[model samples]
Target: MTISCNPKLIACHDCDLLQSLPDGEQRRGKACCARCGAVLHRYSRDSIDRSLALALTGLVLFLVSNLLPFLALNAQGRIQDSSLLSSSLILWQEGNTFLGMLVFATTFLFPLSSLLAILYLLLPLRLGQRPRFSIHVFRYLQSTEPWGMLEIFMLATLVAVVKLGDIATVIAGPAMYAFALLILVLAALSASLDPQLIWRRLDPRCNH
Candidate 1:
């Protein structure tokens, strides 16, 4: 059957083949492209609700990760604790302005913006109200999603701890755990979000 030019229609990213989405019942199974076997889309169960919950949880964890001590170092009878924001400021104060700003943007600003954007879009929809500029906002979220570098930052933190372990005692802080959890939560939030479903809900023209 021919697929209508509706929201339910999708183009395969791999082969650029256009295809219609299966019905709700057929969607319960895997939906693959007929020409290339590339997966088109899988209906995310409770896409909106799951994304909303994950985004809220991610926001809380993001706050905790930035506000609390990320790690503590003890050497020569002196202890130093560093939070995420403090680390960025320290970098800036050390004259590494570009690096500092990059760290702050990738680690702090982008991630926070992503979470907030998710909430901003999903909250109104959850309440049965359409948000203004939602299409633009959602596009912004998609574009900036790649810039969130929490997982990379976490890896760098662990490496720093390892390299410093030879000369000092490294103690994991509450924020470290929270940061780790935030990474996972943000990943889940991204996965749970269905852009097609969101766009369809936001624009009634998709239904026609």
Candidate 2:
């Protein structure tokens, strides 16, 4: 007789307790740790496909958000429209170089990098192929998520709009809507992603 250990074992990140995961189909709800009540996993159906779609959508929206005018101000019969890149550049030209770069990184660079990284990781996985530097790309995605700041930037933009409305006629632009949608889509994508699943798929033993 031969004894075999279950291959679906997972160790809790919080408590480091080793346990076996249920079959994929059985994990409809969140799996919790027996020792510490930590959430071990939340199985999302077709997560890679969903995340890929969202990442692609977010990329398009991101482009529109950067290219089009975010807002237009009509004051004293003069109109001025500001795009994201122009705004950052204006800040830089005004000698707020540090603030400008910070805005650029948080608003534009990090979010774009995250979307590209997601696509790089998920697209290959969806096609039943492995991406090069998969672990590094996934880790980059995780680290960049905190710095995306689209939601925070949008909130600040809304506040500015309200304040400026009293002084000038403020018109919201198409880019604003695209940016808002991008934020929601990115949030959903993040939620839909299962790091454990990706890690498992990336494992050579599991792949074989």
Candidate 3:
């Protein structure tokens, strides 16, 4: 989504104060809420460039989070470490196929797809080419938004730790910590994205 900075009608996201976009060369593209410091529209000066960097980082972290052991437990000198995939497999083995599929879809599939879709949208746009599947990819990301389920995964992790505490000592692994933070950053970035801005840039005549 793309936006042409309208200097005449800026509204504060927090306080709802209406004002004008700032005047002068220095304030040309800067956006700030009129009554509060809240940002209404924001873009990295080189948005496509930054999005690619973030997408690559997110991809690597995602791989580590899924492939490496997510957590570890030690009891009576016996140790166990399991990855996210391992957990899903365990769930399936325990006669919880439906639940296993739920975990797989929400925790792994949707979030990864969203990140990849964002990359597909931004990378091409950054390179001065139109996004190959801009609208469709954006729609997929939007649909997957509610199903990302990182918070649910964290809650389940906590529950597992508590349940296992009586039988074992748990040690959080690097992958566990990384996945938690990656979920947070990904959620933040997705929330901050304004599709209207991209659409405007993509089509000058579309009213958003």
- If scored against the real structure, what TM-score would every candidate get? 0.89, 0.87, 0.72
Residue range 29-68, candidate 2, lDDT tens digits = 7889999999988889888999899999999999999888
Assess candidate 1 and give its lDDT: 0.85
Clashes of 3: 8
lDDT (Cα, tens digit) per residue for candidate 3, span 1-208: 2233553455676898877654433333447775677866654444456556777778888988887778889999999988877776888899999988888888888878988888888877776677666877787887778988877888899999999999899988888987887777776575446554566556635443
Looking at model 1, which ten-residue stretch has the lowest summed lDDT? Answer: 1-10
Which segments of candidate 3 are over 4 A away from where they belong? 1-50, 204-208
**Candidate 1 per-residue lDDT over residues 142-194, each given as its tens digit:** 89988989899888988999999999999999998999998899778777788
Clashing pairs in 2: none
Residue pairs in clash, model 1: none
lDDT scores of the candidates, listed in order: 0.85, 0.87, 0.74
List candidate 2 segments past 4 Å from native. 1-8, 15-22, 34-37
Best by TM-score: 1
